[model samples]
Target: MDTIIQPVARPSKRGSYRRHSDEFKRAVVAQSLLPDASVSRIARQHNLNANQVFAWRKLFGEGQQESGNNVCTLLPVTVVASVMAQPVAEQAPACGGIIELTVGKARLRLEGAVDTAVLHLVLQRLLP
Candidate 1:
């Protein structure tokens, strides 16, 4: 019996493609978060992309205070106060007048004519 052998696939072609060390990732994240340090500049200096540094920072940030002392207890009250402070928008004044229709020299006018039938006919003519 004859057996066939297949070649093993090689790793990525991007030159060894080593992941940055934890310490290096931390340093990059720290520098990117500094008061004046821009993420794009920091990423350029570290040979990385802006998105990569941002992802690391987000992954390592605090979710909530470990002490658990109600950090957001006032959120509901603050939201309610903001909603109550706004004034309602004023409505537009109604214009009540006779409707007029003129086709070539002919003219038709009606006061307070019911619109349902006319609207239906107009819509049916306009649509397929």
Candidate 2:
């Protein structure tokens, strides 16, 4: 795919400022981000400086995170059975759990059903 890309904005003679379209930047950065891809090689193919491609990659990554596209929403999980305590001869099985976390002087203890999403948000704020 060596299609010709017309310059969005560049001095007719010679200069430092060369404005490129966001589409071009995104395309170049996407190519550069592929696994085991060489930034220098990709830049050379697009007739761009490696540093500029790297900068574009950084810009795109920041944009995605800001747009929540790069934000981690949650993890995949499956529930097979309820976690139950051992039952005795004349008693029914009890389902419960305990989770304890300490942050400096603050102590948190959760019993029974635990929402992983809530815990994840809490930890994201609590931990480094």
Candidate 3:
């Protein structure tokens, strides 16, 4: 009895490389910055290489810095009050109090009512 053998498949002579637009790259980088986002997972979802995404972030960041658009923007924050068994009168402060803040390696003690303008100026000088 004679057996038939199948020929092996040959690879293509040319390799295909995809080019992504700047807008698309920026979008992917922004997505990767979202809270709880994983770079590898995002790249997989977008059919991109994790390294490519990281490179895009670096490149985009450099561009932003050069254009003076690297200033930090404040994100919206939420404050949640916890319920207590005790009454509010007992827990409430009698008057304005002092608070301690740790900014970078420096510690600041702000007592009584804090001036928003002063605090803003101090923070602007303290932070990067």
Candidate 4:
């Protein structure tokens, strides 16, 4: 008995390219910004790359900041005096007290009073 050989099939040459609408990208970016949301998980659910979502978020955030919509602004801070058993002069130290600052995901512990210029520089470096 003679056996017939079949020709092998070849893959398609055209590549698949998907285009997403700005509205869709905005919605996905918004979803990714939700508290406790996972970018990888969201991307997987939407059949998108995590990096793409991150890029969209960065672009959206920059636009908002440029428009002064999501710009970071300082609010009035109130400091209250704590009552102590010892006299104020005796209890007070030569240097100022410690200050804890939470900037983004960074936690900074600074002992004594920080200089205005130094603090400004530190914050500028710490922030994006």
The candidate with the higher lDDT, 2 or 3, is: 3
Candidate 4 lDDT by residue in tens digits, 1-128: 99999998998788788899988988888788777999999999999999999999898772352333456756344454564566534654536666666755678777874565788898888765
Backbone clash pairs for candidate 1 read: none
Preferred candidate (lDDT higher): 1 or 3: 3
Candidate 3 residue 95 C-alpha distance from true site, Å: 62
C-alpha lDDT of residue 4 in model 4: 94
Off by over 4 Å in 3: 1-4, 13-15, 62-128
- Which window of ten consecutive residues has the lowest lDDT sum in model 4? 62-71
Local distance difference test, each candidate: 0.60, 0.72, 0.73, 0.74
| TM-score (C-alpha) between model 1 and the true structure | 0.37
lDDT of 2 by residue, 1-128 (tens): 79998879865886688889998888888777677989999999988899999888888783352333345444334464664555445445334866677755667777876666798898887655
Once superposed on the true structure, which residue ranges of model 1 sit more than 4 Å away at CA? 1-12, 62-128
Best by TM-score: 3
Give the C-alpha miss distance for residue 47 in model 4, angstroms: 1.6
Error of 3 at 103 (Å): 34
Q: Give one digit per residue, the lDDT tens place, for model 3 in 1-128.
A: 99999998998788688988987888888888877989999999999999999899898783353222346645344343444555644554424556566654687777765766798898888666
Model 4 misplaced stretches (Cα beyond 4 Å): 1-6, 14-16, 62-68, 71-128
Residue 53, model 2, lDDT: 90
Each prediction's RMSD over C-alphas, in Å, is 22.9, 16.1, 12.4, 12.0
